[model samples]
Target: MGKTPLHLAVTGPSSVVASWILEKDLGLIRIEDVLGRTPLHYCASAANFDLLLKQGASVNHVDKRGMAALHGVCYLGASDLVACLLKWKPRLDLRDKTYGTPLHCGVISGSIDVVMALVEKGAPLNAADANGNTAVHVAAKLGRHNILRLLIQQGADISLQNTNGRDPEAIALDAAGNVGILSILKHKRQDSPESQSILNIVDEDTKASSLDNQVTGNDSPDFLWDEDSMGAAEQNELMGLSQSANDDLYTYEEQQEYCSTTFPKPAPESQSNNGFGKAAFCLPR
Candidate 1:
């Protein structure tokens, strides 16, 4: 890992020793390990992380995985560490290898506080990842009802679709079968000002067409929701859309396992500021 003494001292058992190492040589603050992780990148202790920052540690340095310290802390749901990083004004919307912003990581970690902090700080809410899935898509796909609600309240676009053309509503229904999430999205879309404006326009257009049809005595039949209305090919196409939505999602068990291994719960309060353990190296997937 090519960890220097400064890296070891900060992530080690003693914050006092880490401070001593920093005081001895400030240049160690900028040193990178074999993985290109600076001492700031490995400093899990909020106090130690702050100390390095005060000594001019670079917060924007990305490791081999194209992740900065903000990415790891957000994924770990470490609100304190996240707070420290935010004070430095690190790039709010920096994209990782997967093109996911820090807000996406916070949502994946299932930490409302982390998500709130990012949102309050003005992180881009609608930025999509490489797969065209925005924060809304991720929250819905993972069955995060509360997170989905928060994102919606903060003005995340619910109608945005992913690479497979499945929006959050379809993802909630087909991928997770989350009725609550679907209801929230549906209600937001219907009540949104944009949707209301579109509805009004559509209403006006319909009224004009109805008057024209009445004057011309047009007797063409309109499509209805009957068994004969949809052809075999259209039915097959609808079935394919549902199947594709399901195929694009991970199974519930798989999602749980991924969260467990990829974003370990924050360290206990007793160990919170001690050092980095499983929470330090959350690489982008």
Candidate 2:
């Protein structure tokens, strides 16, 4: 509630007014509201956010909740705002009071773009929150199949367990019986380099035996292939299986409905509250 004129101007609809306020008193950029959020923390508009950064706003400033501007932008799924913050090189792994990194916030916001940006900027994918749940665990528990797949592809540790001793796969199964999510998790584990190496060893052993059988003119076939082994075609099918299942599970409109119904966006008034918004801090702990 103690926001300065600069805070109001930056978050206001007009970027010109914000520029005017900055010109009048550049030090206002460093002023903190009652919640400890500087003007940068409330700059939802990418233009305004960039203006504050160029004007020397601190991207590292945290609100009372221990969330920096980067954390808030990531939670809002504002890729544009995120890009502005990234240029300033903020601490990507800065932990909020809830022990969540920006990667965790991005995952919960359901924006793959935000998640990818943070990942590309070197955010810790396997950073565990207070509950020992990584971004992978949160995505699984929330039935975010696409996000989970991205996390897996980005080298997130799927085997990490939470306080309840539940891994990502276990959490996925508990999330409304999300078999699609479970399948993706299992596929990731199976496709690991270690797993592939073991499988290759077994395949070579079997292939050698088949060659010996063929040389001895045994009744068995000249070549024996393990049905369990995945070929190029099988790999392609497996890759597409999740997408096909997702199509069957949720259409574009239905996905929008699901996200809205499950995680409604905060009201406009709430966006400028002491914290960024309820959604910004409502992440699973």
Candidate 3:
């Protein structure tokens, strides 16, 4: 025989060799045959963690990707294996050699269950990789609507922009073709009135700045608003719209009062000393 039935079991062949090994002898294979997989990887990939784990397989061993059994279980959507992995206290923050975390995998798979599992297990929903991409950005780019909702609900940074100067919403709107995803992205705003007020201010400034640039023959206005600023403004507007649409949205009570008051509020503390009508517009936050 070229290889023993137990060896075939390790190879993941469908030769019923695992059963033969179990029948041939108990504990016949040393723990080392469990290999980098710890049997959990094979079981998870095969959807049979229960039996494999019952036979004393480890749950935290890193595979070739530096992912533990829990990581594998996440992609497999193995609920039981996940529970078992949680019981074992597998490192929730375990990152692959490439710095990819379980949350990254969850977002890519579009599996909300895996997302919730990792989140409940203390996985950082806002954790960014070397590329500064959060789970929200991943979900949005992939158009994972439900996953995006779960992430936003958990307070993922809706405003965090990537190096490419695009926030989650911008990416989602560009890549997301699903109406459901767009609908979810439509509602992750943090401040409506404040954002709207800022945009109105920006628009007025833009027009004035345009005229100033034209008259002065200056190609660049004072701190000309770049694409990044425009995207930030747009993000703020979306957040504002989202908050206004949902009654359950939370806004600062002070801002609410100011927005509702008939009288014009005083200039921001930063602009109080400035000349009349010079309300700190264009000042960097």
TM-score of each: 0.64, 0.65, 0.52
Question: How many residue pairs clash in each candidate at the backbone level?
Answer: 0, 0, 2
Off by over 4 Å in 3: 1-36, 45-57, 97-99, 163-165, 176-183, 193-285
Candidate models: Cα lDDT each: 0.65, 0.65, 0.50
Give the alpha carbon lDDT tens digit for every residue of 164-205 in model 1: 556776556554356677667767767565554322322355
Model 2 bad stretches (over 4 Å): 191-285
Model 2 C-alpha lDDT versus the unseen true structure: 0.65
* Candidate 1 clashes between residue pairs 3 or more apart in a chain or in different chains: none
Clashing pairs in 2: none
Alpha carbon lDDT at 198, candidate 3: 25
TM-score of model 3 relative to the true fold? 0.52
The top-ranked prediction according to lDDT is 1
- Compose the digit string of candidate 2's lDDT tens values, residues 7-50: 55555434665565576668889988666878787675777887
Residue 140 shift from truth in candidate 1, angstroms: 0.7
Model 1 ranges with Cα > 4 A deviation: 12-14, 191-285
- Overall local distance difference test of candidate 1: 0.65
